[model samples]
Target chain A: MKLPRLLTRPIAQPPPHPSAQLVGDLAARLEASARRRLGRGLALRHIGTGGCDGCALELIATRNLVHELESLGLRFVDSPRHADALLVSGPVTRNMREALEQARAAMPEPGFVVALGDCAVDGGVFKGSYAVEGGVEAVMPPDLRLPGCPPSPRQVLEGLLALVEAQA
Target chain B: MTPAEFLRQPPAQGPTHALTEPQWEALAADPELPLLALWGEPGVVRAAFQDGNALRLVALAAPEGQYPALSPARPAAALFERAVHDLWALEPVGTQDGRPWLDHGRWPVLNPLSGRPVRHGGAPPQPEFLPAEGHALHRLPLGPILPGIGEPAYLHLAVAGEAVVRMEARLGYAHKGVLALMPGKSPRAAARFPARLQAEATVAHSLAFALAAEKATGTEPPPRAVVLRAVMAEIERLSVHLHIWAQVLALAGPPALADQAALARETMLAASQIAFGHRLLMDRVLPGGVALDLEERGLSILRDALLLLAEDLPRLARATLRHAGLVEALTGLGVIPPALAQDYTAGGPVARASGVMVDARLGPDASPYDELELEIPLHPEGDAAARLRQRIAETAESRRLLAVMLDSLPDGPIITPLPQRGGEGVALVEGPHGPCMAWLALDDGGLIRAAMARDPAWALWPLAEAAAAGAGLEQLPLLLAGFGLTMSGMDL
Candidate 1:
């Protein structure tokens, strides 16, 4: 009889992400222009349209418990006016079109967007619904996309980290 | 003839009992059966009510569009009625507050459920939201997009000075027409909708749908399958409660406590994955029984985790209660009067905190919990503190119950094949929040014709109005944190 392992196995090394390379390019260009304008590091404002609510759960966990995104110089802002980037989840719904647009307009220029969850990338299971308007691209183009029903907390952390390191 | 005689079960074997308007009104407002849902189809509308041990199902025919409203008598039916109108275009004749709930009129189709043809190009209907206006009373909107984490819901607060005069919550931003999508799909395939509606309460919703399907088709799952279902439900309850407590702690600051609460939840999630294959136990509970059987090693890990939870949760709860300023902020905050809880039929911690002692598992209904002696936590305060205390008590109870069910684990098949013929069934499973119910009506082809899954959110969301009524604006977050209402569940 074997005693089963209780702990989760460590996450394996990831292949290089094309979005990561693309986001790195954008961040590098944006950082050169905007370093003098902003005081603190990158700020995130998240908008949910219509989703299963999985990514937001993992997002909060990453920021609050394990990853503590603030330590890496990323703070979640209440107002989009203070944000440098927008973290959007769920498929864009027609009802939320105005709200999503206004939030993006309010944010400062270099309006970086990171789409979270498979729904945000491609609308996942909710794609065909009459209310859904497809992914973040329907309203705002995403600089980077994190894919999963919900990508793990570690995955969320990795995506944000990649974007920040790209500015360097 | 007596009303019972006229309400004979429809020959289709679906749980529907077709009734005239007079019969529907009489049965709907009957002091016995409480109306659960009133939804619509092409020409006919269905009303489901839970009457004591047996569920009473009734349907009303609306040839000319309008039908008598149930919300005038039972306040809980308002949202369902509004939903019916929004999707089906079937008007609830005299229901007060005829405002649309789900339809923002932004869709390509006017009434998507009405089978009205969608035009290729059309102007979107512009939704107008007019808040309560008074001198120095301004509307403060919270979220279609909130600060940190959550599903999209807009709570319109009309504030006069420091007090919230009225709070009108506008949901349906997450409405993907989950109920509409279920029809014409196999029961097994449609199972995914309910499972993801509230991601935190996946197993409970899945189990509810499964049990409902079983009841409709008249197939009782094996005892082992029943026990396994209970096991998953209990684990889900534990995870959701822990997550709620973590949110509350984060709100009642000092940050460290919230971090600890999250760590505990992570530990629970890891255990679930080790036992089952998924972290949230998504797609695990099915129509017949369960998706996977737990191996010996998985069982061992689960047992150990439950034991650890039993030991750790109580200690964490005590520390939280004793923490400086927590009691001051939590107690007497967001106090909900007993009347509000009863009127709305608020279940779970919200109702228990208000001292309403109702739990699905403890009832006379037979299932996995028939033999085990269980305690339903009752706190009479109905405040934020009481709700917190109730969640802690329930979490500990879940851990204990999980241990008990695991010990008496049976040795038979984990699934019983579902019947070839389709029928109607209703299931009630105790979610961490409260009793989450699934009422399923499958067609002769064993595919879903109509289905409705009601989360405890239906009962609890209205109480947010009562809870925030007299409280100052400063205390709203504490109230919301303790309440732990799911916008996703409500919107769906």
Candidate 2:
């Protein structure tokens, strides 16, 4: 059966797991950058301007005891201005499109954007809704994508860790 | 509509209706009975009130003019009326606070559901938010984007120094016009909207849609299907309550306590995946019946998981509640009185915390809940601590129900064939949040004519404002977290 043309748009697909090669390479780079690091800590900001709360729940899971992204020196910041990277989830609703843009703009220079879930990548089931604006790429392209209705907490951690390693 | 036509229940057991629009005001007058369902269509609007097993429904067909809005008499009708005006353009005469609720006036078309063109102009400017003002109080706008909040919703908090004097939530950032999408699709296809409303509560929503579809189409799932659907719903509630407990803990304090809660929740999700093939349980329920059945291995995993959780959860709840800081912080913050809860129609834990005894599970609805020895835990204080304790109690109860269902798993076919005919039907399911409902009308070709899925959160968000007033600004997170309302559920 043919899929709807709008939903068939190219969305970044996650590798079965995080790219071990890139994650390793980035880890090496981070280890040698103590002098370059400002050491203000990893102030990551998450934005889920639309879509269901699935990705947000899994993302929160990464902060709990089992996944402990905090112990990895990462923490959530209240404002986008204080963040090093923007972790975005869900399809961008039309109303939230501007807020998403403004949030990305508020982040200081060299900040990366990581989009989570199929909704963020390709708008998932909400693509055809009149109130929705297709996907995250419609507003700003993401540096990383983790796909699923909600990618598992392990998958979310892999994506965030890889993003941090790349920045380091 | 005439009183005689209104004084009848749908063949399927939806909240029963028996009054005209004017009588609806009388139903609203009884503060003890909570109003459960409210929505509108062209020519008519409907409301359902619940008292134990009995439901009093009222439908008003305006004689080609504005009908009175119950919002003036019932504060609970605020969101439903605003939404009715926004979507159907059915002006509620004498309605208070008619400012757009769902529509931000940003659409190229006004009343898109009613198919009206944008009225001779571009979308108007975003209106300024005029909140209820007070002395020495300043407004602090919260979000349409918070990294941690899963959906796009804003909160206007009236603050005096460090104290939150009041809260006004502005949602609709996630409103996807679900009703608009419902029409023209087959009931099977439309099932996706109700299920996706809130992923955490997917089972309850889908079950509601399935129930509504089954009712409208005059089809029935096999006995086995009903038992399985109930089990899935209980599992969904378990996972949700566990996750909410963890979230409330993490948002407040004691990250270590949150971790234990997450571990138990993860165990449930893993078992759910092993049984249902979906961690979130989306699309597992379809119209007329379930999409599939759980295998023996899946049932065993769930049975084992429940046993472990039953032993571990109470210990976790005690440890967290006994913590000195938690006790001090949660004790008196965000106390909504029983009268206010009834007035605002606070739902799920929020309503139950304030001593509102309304549970669809315990009602005269056609479900196995009437068969099982289930307990709906409630609290009287209506404070953050009471809400937290309420969740802990409900989580334990959900686990107990899961064990009972799994042990007595019925043997039969899982689904009924989808009907090709059309009719009007309504479904009510007690979701993790509280009671969620769905209404659908099918066309001659078996396409959906109109549909509405009522999330319990829609009625509860306004009560969040009442709950947050007079609490310290720092305590707002705990207050909001304990209430555990979802923004997407509200907007949709």
Candidate 3:
């Protein structure tokens, strides 16, 4: 009797870069940005129009034990106006359009948007539904799109971190 | 057939109409009046029942036209009856509200079978606004169509100066005729739809379907498969609870709890990676057995992961509870008092949070759950805080269970073959969200008769009514977060 392959595959190798110089430049810039925005803190808020809740799940996970995202000082806020970054999920249904617009408008300036999951990126399988308005991109341009049926919490955290640095 | 005998039999045949006197008495004593059962054929259980006074009804998915109309007895059944009527074109004996459930007003359609247009045209009626009754009594119209983070639902709040006098909910935006979609597939293949029914409880859905199929076929997955399924299910539960807890925290305004949320995500991904190879653990579960096995290394990884999570989960739990704003906002708000929780047929942590000791796995007469020593925690408070606390405690227990199951791991063939003529089956598994039930019927050729997945929220929706009571219009966000019902589960 044969045993099935049960071990999880390893992460794929990332694209190559100019080793030492690229690392130094990236690290220096990231540190500089972090230092500049140290006390202000980034406020994160998430909205789910109608995705499978995968992104929402991962977003929540990113804040917990494995990801420990709070170490970076990113916080979630209630109102969009209080947020420095908006994490959006779902395909932006017709019913949710007004709320989405209201949230976007309420956000303070110098904010970035992170689109989580395939639904937010392209509406995935739910695209053709009459009530669906396609992806979040259909409603507003996203600064960073973290793609996955629902990206891992670490991926979401990384995306948020990258957006904050870029904005900073 | 006696209820005991019927319960013992695989859920293959149309539900045995014969009921023992005690069983009939129990059914009769149900607080909800008017449970109508329809059996269009010998072996299909298409039942509809409801509580007329509560203004809610439950329509179990079944063969087309087999669902009966309880609208004559219960006003709430009127909406569901119309929905079933529109989708399957199944004629309800008598329907009160003629408005269609799934049909969006454009009714006339060319009937290919009759070669004529079938139309039910009615004059568009004037929109009568909610009438004010007396001094300080005015209707606060919310939305059947609102924005932000929810499926299409309308809320009608009768308020006077920020105080709610009455609340009503209108839902059906995401309904996709799932019951109508289940026929024609094999029982095993049909099992696929249930997990998707409520993505959060996918593992529970998978387990219930598999268990039901197992019971029908008179086979259980090898010992190893059972343990693996349990491990995977627990991990899935942890993932969802963590998500719910974080959302509750965020909704109550604590930005710092994202760390806990991230940790929960890590646990979910790691467990899925260790057990099934996919993050969401999709397609990993199959009828009769699991598609993958736990290799030695994967087992160790799981053992280690569970240990780590168990050690660290407490701090995250404490942080959320200790947070001043969260406690103040959630402590007494959105209470699903014990009595109401039961009336709503609430399941999972929501039901447990309200002191109901109902769990599919914990039933003494049940299988795998009967084999394992299951401990359920119940609280009588039944508020948002209790629900959150219940989740935290359950997360710890789930971690312990996963660790134990992995340590006592069994080894054997991963997948079990489905006989050429797969049979009917039904499963009831306790999920993190609540009781998740899956039912399947296979044809002689192994094709599916009907597959249905019922989420705990089917019962918990009424609790929303209780939670919405007295909640001001502005507190809608907290109320929604606290109730935490999954719209996708019902929509599918």
Candidate 4:
């Protein structure tokens, strides 16, 4: 019996997975370099401020088999206390301003913030709205800024790897 | 009464009608008309109702800054009324729950949407949750910053031991003041807001917004654009359903199946990126038409993705069912009663699983859907398993539709220019989660005068509260994952 192409393909096939040839050699090397530098994995605690779920969806996609940051020494944690970085998305709204600060404060020493998506980086299209308080920088300093209305799963992985490598 | 019978007294062809105060109250009292959405603008308050095949809007003058509350009779109008009050300061007289819905008193100015905005002074007051009175019941607050990659919204679960006595969600933490931001911008410029309303349902929201803009401007997208829009919407539904399926399986145990489902979702996202130029299909659908027409490369990519999904989906479903533990975990958990679902006018898989047949795609005036062979999957079980099965069935149906659409692809100009003129329009599209509705009034110069995009999560969130009753606290995440409602979608 003939098997499907996806199932038949070997699990580890360099970088190109299925459709979009997103994960290339650079992403893999960054993953390895970050892992070596940190001596462990990076744990992220994500918080959504006031933007759309575009960035959040990409973040979730990074956990899928194609990207699977978990296998490459990056993971998401439930509490801020367990996190090594606070990955925040969206334009910081007034309502979530305090919550974002509290979550940032809860992170241990040497921990940094990664602002994901254009909204987080500079409030994107929602900038200057009465409710929005600009971007992550408006509330707290961000160690890394990944741009794109929402950076794709591949972009998100590369950004995280770069952040870990630089910080470590 | 059937929707046809409910619309026996047909309203005019236009979107809105000015009604007297008494007429507005009488219409609100009428059981036949289910309140689709409510919003306030300046001296007038508008309410939309699904009138058989068409959308009907009724406006009442609120010159004194207050109007008779529809929530007193409609129940579904409660959140809409609260949101209207929060944004416009148009008080809902005699509202059962007058607490702010979207505005947490955190904005710099009060009545931000009102023509005359007032600056706020002191720090915002703490939000009050509905009190739960019972012995041994303690309150547990969940979020505003939830686990994993989900959006933020505060959930207060009143629990006695492990069982949840009651659950209340405090939303608006993810609100971006989308309505307030759209007024001065042109339709082309404002299109981004609705598409970003919910990432998972971007195509659906964009399509609805585009349709509303098109209607307001009296423009029709070419046949190819219509067909392409349908294809994109179907792909979004397929992708989101798979994502939810994976999350549910991951929580229910069996990581292998979850991995397979996630892989399938990733493949779909890749196809979307290749075909539509955006993974989530955001900003692809615009007021005039689609941003880009599908070329040979995109078509081939989509064909390959569909072929792969066809082979993988059924196997994944079968493997999921083979696990007794997974089946047991999902079955009979988070059941939403059909009556309650109908009361709140739930749509999409949630309503279908509850035996309340409500899919905007299946409505009489659902254009491209009317042309395509569509199936409304229904299950009386109304539990987590039922919802999962609904998605699987719908995904299969979407795959079939995509194949059919690809085979009979139309050739034409993808867009038509919109005329710069004053008009009002409303549109409803069946999204991944449910039916998303968009209402907009364009100024004479084609700039947005007022707009409101209502996500189905607004209705589904209340049903989530209902489904959480009597469930163990640990099951809350699984239950929410099954529903897959977006906080940003509803908050906007």
Candidate 5:
């Protein structure tokens, strides 16, 4: 019995994407930093404060096989209590300000904050809207800021690596 | 009047018809005409409907800061009316659910989009979830902030034992005051707002906005630009459908298959970046025409990417069907009856899965799609499985459309000069999710006087609530993944 051509044909393996390579390098750096300073892996808790979901989609892409950050002992946790970092996205809208503060307060001492997009960094396109309180900085200071309309997965990994290195 | 009767009348070339109060009420209660969108601007409120082939807009004056409620007749008008009241301080005379829709009471100004904005100082009001009373029933609250990277939205679930008795979603956590932001800016400068309304449907929303602006100014983009816009839209649909498949597969089982879907999506994104200079194709479709042209090298890259997706998607679908765990988890789960879907006017895969054959691409406003071969996938089951299958079918159809458009690629300039002039225009484009409508009133200087972009999610969210009513509480995420809705699009 012969299988259909679709099942029989080998799945094409495109060359490793440049973002994958950048993620690999960043993972190596983060792993070394974790061993040297924290004696444990980093745990991040993400919150979408209120911009478009482009940054969130890119952030999720970082967990894919090509950019598997989890393999480097870094993972997203369900609660801020278990997190070493609070990864915030969007413009920190007024409706989300309390929720954002509550998540930050629940984290352990010295848990850093990383703002993940232009909206999070300084309210990018939604700057003067009445519904938003500008950016993450308006609610609380961020330890690191990654800016793009919404940064790519490679840029996200790079930003994480920078945060880890600076903390170490 | 029935849709057939409305179609018999001569088509009105004007953007909107000024209807008397009685006429507006009659149209609202017609039952046969599906309401596309209802929005307010100053002293007027406009309602758009699918009048056979063309979009019909009817306007009524709200001089006393109030108007007759359409929700009394068309149950689907409930959300739209609530949103209008929230943003414009226009009272819906006899609405059953007059709760604040988009204004969560946290904004610095109340009725921010109203002509005269007022400052509010009190603490934001807590949401009032619908009551669910039963013995041993407990409430389960999820989000505004949940586990995993997704948009923020609050869900209140009333569960009894293992089953959910009721589910009410309190969204508006992601609202950015988009309506208030668009009014004063030129269409070129304000194009970014519509593009950002829904990240997954950026191209669809941008195209709809551009079409509305172009129609308002009576500008016609070159032939090449029209075809390229359609090409980009097809690519967007493919990518979004793939992403939804990846998410559904991740939830149902067989993680390896999920990876395959994710990789395919990545390939599409990479191709988009190579062709249009942006992964999501944001800001690529502007008012007069597209911002960038497809060069020869980029065109070949896109062709190769589409071919790869065409081959890979079928294998993933086959694997998914063979997995018994996925099959059992999805089959007969979160079922939405066809009657309920039609009543709510659900669109996209959700509506198509329930056997609704409506597609904006096949409508009168569909330009290039009118020339291309477009197929509407229909499933009678209306389950999670059916929705997934609908996406798979749509993905194949989009691939075929892309191949044809690329083969017959036209040659010409990409843009036309949009003269600064006053007019109103409405456009409906079939987004990946469903029919997305954009209506705009342009000032003499081509600045936007008023605008509204409606995502199909508005109709689908209520259907999702209906689907979740009798399902097990554990199945909530699977049901949501099946719907694949974005809160920003709704909240905007």
Candidate 6:
């Protein structure tokens, strides 16, 4: 289908502050150093059990143009076996507990799990649900947590980079 | 509109029974029965169904909000009375059990609703945990503190190995008094609160709230606003469906499914940026109409993205259906009977998958829906596979509807300014997870008197009890995904 044309032009946006840019650049250098030294080959894998899909969407955006997480040589893998770090989102549901455990078990030794978003960190509001199994801590211990309703992709990238540094 | 006509006025006793004034006169005068299902939210009609026999008055309250304890009956009102006492601080004159149902022991202040300190001079009701007794009963404690996901609630499970004998869930962790907060804000501003209840379905919630306000005030949004609302609602549906579908893939653990999920997510991000200028579309829906309007360019971007989604969704769905292991895992797990669904008044795909064909958009005499051409899909098994199938089918249907609505886009200004004075109204929208109902009651000052949103998770949460029976621990993820219950919506 032919798409409609833009009715109005978007306002020009300002660039990030130099201080913020420097911080981002330093973070990028740290991630690179970690990948070369302590973390020679570690891939990130995203997992979503039964969340609203908000966190998962943000994670996907990390690899896109804006965040460019892939430029740091960070690749998102599909299986836990090849993953050096696991980025799990949502409260683990009762139905998903066993599979989650099995996935965690499949992860290589020394690999870490990062519970992303408010839902994953502590099960946020879904703490006492019958259908839910509880937060990531209930399913598997996490090395780090990035909290927010759905953390921004920039924040997610920063957190992931920080995780790599910790591993180093 | 006559009060009797516009409102699904409850019978003299309840919705099921009509008690004429003289018969119920004394009770009404005495405030013996708390009003039930007083507000209408778009697709769902909540009626306070009386629970228990005489001697106590308990109500299976729906829509949203705690029904005040009715007097005249004592023992029967214990649960209702206790629930109200803990939730909204509506104390019943006489009650049996009072140990706070909601007090988690750490609330900083007296629950503003209760007017007393969190823990004070009042005699605490004897704490009574659910008894676990049955054939080979074993307690399976899920979470007051869990691993991943939002909200804080607990499930006390009485199980024999893998099979659940009985399951009871303790919720209300995210109760921010959304209803109590609603009555004081202007409807236009109040609309923002409900939209964020569940981030993914923000537009659906906002639209539902706005529709209710419009209905109550006897105002129709401009035709363009209607079309915009439809577009926003459909886009919201598409984004959520893609997300839910991705969750199902990730649960199934198939590589192809993961790739498909990534693609779907990309489509959602792109479409969101083009339409509402935000991936989640939060606060874009206003009381009178949509806060943001998509002009020609934005519409084109969405159309292109949707075309790709429509093309790809079917292939992924087929792959999911044909995958042997995935099919085996989902086929008959978590089956909720039609009778149970009706009792709970389940809405959305959970109800539809179980043969309950109540779609607020297409129900009898439903305007707009009556004029719109669409298909109503149903599956009777109510199993995991059936629910997944329903989601896929609905996704396709919603996509088709979106394209049609866009093609015949209405012409006019995007918003219809609301009058300064507001009125009571209710609206319902079929959210991705299920039907989301928002009720708005304006105070005399044109501020929101009460705003309560009922997410589909309320009804589906109970079904988890039934779904857990006889299933091994390994298959729960697919079973839960099949239901597509939203945790945030449930918490609210």
Which runs of model 1 end up more than 4 angstroms from their true locations?
Answer: A1-41, B1-14, B28-32, B52-54, B117-135, B363-366
> Which digits, one per residue and each the tens of the lDDT, describe model 5 over residues B111-225?
8877888998898887887889889999999887976788898889999999999988888888888888998788889999999998888889999999999889888878898
TM-score of every candidate: 0.90, 0.89, 0.72, 0.94, 0.93, 0.71
Ranking under DockQ, best-scoring first? 4, 5, 1, 2, 3, 6
lDDT of 6 by residue, B204-279 (tens): 7787888878766767787777777777777777766666666777778586575565566666666777777777
lDDT, each prediction? 0.77, 0.76, 0.61, 0.84, 0.84, 0.61
Candidate 4 CAPRI assessment class: medium
Candidate 2: misplaced stretches above 4 Å? Answer: A1-17, A20-43, A71-73, A165-168, B1-34, B53-57, B62-65, B117-124, B128-133
Candidate 4 C-alpha lDDT tens digits along B1-492: 443253444556556777788777677677576777888898789987765435667788999999988887777899999989988889998888989988888888998988899999787888888888888898888888887777889999899999999999989998888988899788888898998888888889899999999999898889899989999998999999999999998898688788889889999999989988889888889888899999999999999999988988988888887789988888899888887876777788998998888788876338787877677778889999899889988889999999899887799898888888888888989999988989899989988999989898988889999899889988888898989878887888
- What tens digits encode model 3's per-residue C-alpha lDDT throughout A144-163? 67788667766676666555
Off by over 4 Å in 3: A1-49, A60-147, A154-168, B1-45, B48-68, B71-82, B91-154, B176-182, B187-192, B215-219, B253-258, B261-265, B315-328, B473-476
Using TM-score, give the best candidate's number. Answer: 4
Pairs that collide, model 1: B216-B424
Q: How much of the true contact map at the interface does candidate 5 reproduce, as a fraction?
A: 0.71
Q: For residues A57-151, could you state the per-residue lDDT of candidate 5 as single tens digits?
A: 88888777666767655789989999988889999988889999999999987577889899999998888999889989999988667898779
Ranking by TM-score: 4, 5, 1, 2, 3, 6
Looking at every candidate separately, what fraction of the true A–B Cα contacts under 8 Å does it contain? 0.65, 0.64, 0.21, 0.87, 0.71, 0.07
All DockQ scores: 0.55, 0.44, 0.16, 0.72, 0.67, 0.10
C-alpha-based local distance difference test score of model 2: 0.76
In candidate 1, what are the lDDT values of residues B1-492, reduced to their tens digit?
455445544435455677778887776565344565667776678776654334567778888768888787778888888888888888887788788888877777767877663543456555546557678887787887865677788888889999988877778888877777788987788888888788877888888888888887888788888888888888888888888898888888557777767877877777878998877888888888888998998899898877766666777888898986888888888888776776676677888899877677764334878777777779999899999999988888888889888888998888877776778787777788877778877788888887888888887778887678778888888888777677666666
Per-residue lDDT of candidate 6, residues A58-134 (tens digit): 77666543455766657877667877777877777554555567778888866677889887898755555434556
lDDT against true structure, model 6: 0.61
lDDT score, residue B415, model 3?
70
lDDT of 3 by residue, B202-275 (tens): 78877877776766666757777777787788888877777677667666756656544654556657767765
